[model samples]
Target: MSADQSVAIVDDDDFFRKALERVFHSAGFRTESFAAAEAFLASYIPKDEACIILDLRMPRLGGLELLDRLKERGIDVPVIIYTGNADVPVTVQAMQAGAYAVVEKPLSSELLITRVRAAITDARARRTRRNQSASARAKLKLLTEREIEVARHLTEGLSSPEMADLLGISPRTVDAHRANLLRKLEIRSIAALARLFVLTELGDS
Candidate 1:
């Protein structure tokens, strides 16, 4: 996990929330606590959040409702919800709403820490993928129309001569376009270029 990444604890219980903050701090994790879900959402920063430790039973905006709000805003931060009684129906509902994990209340400190570490690791992986996809899409926007066509052909495993034949251009011209696109995208190999296409979702069609 990044040094600056932090866990956001949303619980209405003052004592429980404070205890969780101390536990996370002792385990070398930074924590931000909110007395209510509304407050957490009001000041939430998507990029800084490694995970959310949420209390399911809260006043006003409950944990499941907050999950819906996060989804509406397209925030994919991992959320671990804890409730006094995690009944089957409620647990199913939370899972359907994209809660990363659901745990019962009075959770053991060791178990909480272990799950938190896993959630943070997952969040970091997700953030890295999002960054890579954004970078690939931005670099692709710098390519010329012809270069983009060549890039698509390269991803499709077409040889320079084959692409040239399909594109109604000479093999030498196709090679030039291919080289230019590779340079513009800052990718050195066809395999890497293909992976970039996958990242940008340009290969789906």
Candidate 2:
């Protein structure tokens, strides 16, 4: 995760919120607390890079409702539910609703920190994968039919001379196509391009 990653905590209890905020701050996370789920939802953007620490029960727009809204919107921020309510059905529901973890309250500082870090890490990984997919799609959009063919060959470790021979073009033309490929793909080197190609292939699959 980047230094700017945020963790939003939504708990109605004032003292607990402050304590958790302090703990998260001490653990080197940029933390924000909201007394209500509605306040947090209204104030915060649904950024995939951020993680949410939500109280399972709240006044209006409870954590479960908030999670439902997030899912409906296709927002994939990781959620860690923390609540004193340890009912089996509630825990099972939270997990089924796609919460990263459901933590029981009277929260252990060490355990909370560890879970938050892991959730943030998971969120960051998901965000990175989504961004890569978007980038690959953008690059694919920029490609002409010929360029797509060239890119496929490039991923196969074909040299410009070899590509030129295969495509019945001059080596200079192949070099030009390769340069265009790099710019269109927004990648610097063959390795990066190859990685993009792999991602594209995986996305297709």
Candidate 3:
């Protein structure tokens, strides 16, 4: 993620929230503070570019509940849970709910920073993969029905002659379709095309 990426800190305690904001700000991260989950959800856009620092306890909807809401909406931002209790069950539950980290309250600046950095890195990787998948889907949309058939065979590592034989088309036509698929996908080689196919499959699944 970029240095401009922000972190949202949601904690009911004013002192802790302000302290966390200061720490994040000093580390070159833009920070926002919300006293409750509802305020944060109402105010923030669910961008995959940002990370969320969530307090496990709050007045209205708790951190776990907020996490569920985000997941249901397919918002893939990274979340780190902060809590004073530090019980084993709570920690396990947070991790199971896809929290990047569960940190105890009276937080360490160093550990918190490290976890935030890791979460941002993970978020960026996921965003990149999603973008690549979108590109692949767009490329696939350019294919004609016959070209798509040829492309699928090519993605399965079939040679031009093999695809021609299987589809009962001329070798020259199969080769033409292969070249068109490459150009449409903006890929230089068959290996890159195959990778795009795999990525598209994974994205759909």
Candidate 4:
């Protein structure tokens, strides 16, 4: 983990939250602690955060509801939730709602450290993918409408003549648009163009 990246500990238990902060510090991680979910939500920005350690049972906005709120806001920070009683249904629901991992209370320090390290690694990978997708979308925006259509057809494995027939344009014009797509996207081959299209589409979900 980077020195600037801090783990966010959101739990109502002051003692436990402090203990977690200490543990993270001992493990060479910086931490930000909150006594309540609402307080954390109010001040938290998504950047420079490694992951969130959320308590499952809070007063107003519970862990699950907080997860939903994060999703609504399109925050992609990985969250690892802890609970005193982690039953099957609740664990399933938490996982479905985008909790990175669920752990029962009385967590071992070593286990916590290991899981947090893995979560941070996963969060970095997700950030990289999002950055790549954004770059792909920006590059795609430089293409004209006809060039975009040609790129789509290229991904579909359509020949220039076939795309021209379907688009009601001459094959020569289709080839021109294809060449322009390659130039504007700075790609050499049709395969790279297809990959760029897929990368741009990854952010849609």
TM-score of 1: 0.81
TM-scores of the candidates are: 0.81, 0.68, 0.84, 0.85
TM-score of 3: 0.84
Steric collisions counted per model: 0, 0, 0, 0
The candidates, ranked best first by TM-score, are 4, 3, 1, 2
How do the residues 2-33 of candidate 2 rate in per-residue lDDT, one tens digit apiece?
35677898999999999988888887778889
Residue lDDT tens for model 3, 34-127: 9988998788786555789999998879999999988887778899999998799999999999888888887789888888888988778877
When sorted by lDDT, best at the front, the candidate numbers are: 4, 1, 3, 2
Question: Which pairs of residues have clashing backbones in candidate 3?
Answer: none
Q: Which ten residues in a row have the lowest lDDT in candidate 2?
A: 196-205
Query: What tens-digit string does per-residue lDDT give for candidate 4 at 21-123?
Result: 9998888887889999899889988863588999999999899999999999888888999999899999999999999999999889999888888888877
- Per-model C-alpha RMSD: 3.2, 4.7, 2.7, 2.4
Q: What is the lDDT for 21 in model 1?
A: 92
Q: Cα miss at 52, model 2 (Å)?
A: 1.4
Comparing 2 and 4 on TM-score, the stronger one: 4
Number of the predicted model whose TM-score against the real structure is largest: 4
Better of 2 and 3 by TM-score: 3
Q: What is residue 17's positional error in candidate 1, in angstroms? A: 2.7
